[model samples]
Target: MILRLTLAAIAFAATLAAPLRAEIAIQEVTSPGGIKAWLVEDHNIPFMALEIRFRGGTSLDQPGKRGAVNLMTATLEEGAGDLDAQGFAAARDGLAARIGFGANSDEVSISVQALSENRAEAMDLLRLALTEPRFDAEAVERVKGQILAGLRADERDPSAIAARLARARSYGDHPYGSAGDGTTDSVTALTRDDVLAAWQGAMARDRVYVAAAGDITADELGLLLDKLLSDLPETGWPLPPPATLNTAGGLFVEPFPGPQSVVLFGHGGIAFDDPDFFAASLLNDILGGGRFSARLMSEVRDKRGLTYGIGTGLSVRDLSAEWMGQFQASNDKVAEAITVVRAEWARMAAGEITETDLATAKTYMTGAYPLRFDGNDAIANILVGMQMLGLPSDYPKTRNDKVNAVTLDDLKRVAARLLKPDDLFFTVVGQPEGLTSSE
Candidate 1:
């Protein structure tokens, strides 16, 4: 059954490729209550996908109330208005609607899908979730237990440890360094009042970005927007201050009971709006973002047999950005792997890429771009993400051209400016030999 469903989804996606490639005409919609959204009308499907994003997600958690926002988001769909958890779930299931909410470091996102015939009822359900979430005490405790269980599991995970350590080292005292799920102790300490405060602070109209796709017209979407979000506060919480990278380059190893080491490495990266962002992206692709074809994969895995897989990419965040990479290797081979990685970094900085490298990277990037617009939900999510990154509306049309326009000189210049082998920091977890923390 899963395989059959997968094939059907793939066929549906293929049907959308042609129309999507022709340019989806996005309409700027304004509700009667003054809320705004981006709408892509497509009557071919009977359902619509709605994506709403609010900036200052978990980062807006009060200093001592670290996990409150995350917990609140989890409980939004658990119950709302006059319904208990099971009651809400049954009502939503009866309508065959889907609604989800989640919080990360930069944003709180809500996703909804409902058929045109049941959209009005679905919107009311969504409105209830947003404006009148019960966050019942029993539900809160249940969700908190689930979160605590995950936190405990992460404590035993080498990859999770390395990731947490990397952010802690990179961002220092900033909220970005803290885990979005909060610590077990912090979560255990949360009260119902804390959850309510987090909900109030994180869900507001001022920071909201909305995008809708599928069977929805502009006028209808505008009215739906007012119905769903007009009750949210005009302004909720102030965003956290920008984080400065505090990393000092060197290997930082945490001893774990494993023969293999998980390594996370990176340096500062270009912002999304920078003119040379696409060049840096292509450079990253050739160096490590191209999966099997990346230089790191070719040199480290294919040639040296040091690790199973290695890859890197740019991370453009709301308040900060970095070029990051990760890989796992046998304890004895980790030193060699790091040596090879640094060599590749230095070689790229020295401009050793060939025309074939540029061509392959461009082809992969451009060809893969269209596949992301395959489904209405995917398109809606991308539209909201583009807004979050401050991208222009024509970005969808011009994105591939920007990728294709990158010249060898552009890659060379960007590589020289952005690649800093000496500044690279490594956070290694496991019993890796011959590696020591500089600090």
Candidate 2:
């Protein structure tokens, strides 16, 4: 009860605080052991959120050991050092701290929040979880059961089926192609050793990036970094190579008996660091930016009533990206819906956007940008993310300018380079009447 109240207070405080301005300074600090982190110091509320991200997340899984890293990450809080799972939870609650561990294709992330009064104890607890995760047999088995259950559920989910099929077809034999959670056979066969190996391969100093917001100083953060991370191994496993994308265009249908078919479509996308990325973003917005006003939603859902929602995005990975989108329509309407999408895709490929379209997208993107920094925790994550993306500290100040700088010609250039209608592929999952597998 006390822990809940403390956390609620932090949330409440964030609500009362003013939105962070772009001119706010981000200080980069390095620890005694040479580990570096970004800091945004706000001493107002006696609370702080610390985020640690280790690059090369589940992509570092060893051959035949898929899901080991994911399972290891889940078990970090199960037990550590002299503490059991129950003990760890009790200790964290006692400190009024919230600590979480997560993993995705590109990184493993650790988040910690604590009040100023109990910060040292919270850090010590986190240090144990990182350095000495027990991964005991009982705990590992329980967590494995949970993962297996989720995998079974994924089999029945239409959206998951479409996404999995798309990944398999688009990125054959790459880490990107396979499920992050191991298949039933692979996960069932996993032993305790694999979990420990995954721990060593994933959680290490070399790949770590850190960020903090609120109630902390650079000097104090330097000491905390060493105290928290110094005991871990210096390096982890090598990151996987870039995905070899199959950019070929086709419509492949997987027959699942459902009233509606879930469609996933895309081809190659621009790189994250590309100079024209801002233009690509604007183009995607005009085409299908998950908003009701975007072209795809306007054409397919609003006018045609084929589906409730249809949206698109750039699925950017470490060294790869794909222009991706998803939508659902009844089995009968799937063909018409897809036809309309392809028409819109081809239309965008021809650099057919208006001045008004460009201006509205720019206004929306630039206007909504500052609201992202709504609270200290969000700002902390943004700081870490900017560093990971190789963005400068002053990026917040310049981002609106960058968004507003793209002229019509630049958008057209990106549209010409990207938006390949011939290369677009669709993975449709359901028993639709007209769609079929094509090459």
Over 4 Å off in model 2, which ranges? Answer: 18-20
Candidate 1's C-alpha runs over 4 A off are 1-22
TM-score of each: 0.96, 0.98
lDDT scores in order: 0.89, 0.90
Per-candidate clashes come to 0, 0
In terms of lDDT, the best-performing candidate is: 2
What is the lDDT, from 0 to 100, of the residue 132 in candidate 1? 95
lDDT of 2 by residue, 251-359 (tens): 9999999799999999999887999999999999999996799999999999999999999999888868999999999999999998999999989889899899899
lDDT of 1 by residue, 26-47 (tens): 7778889888788788887677
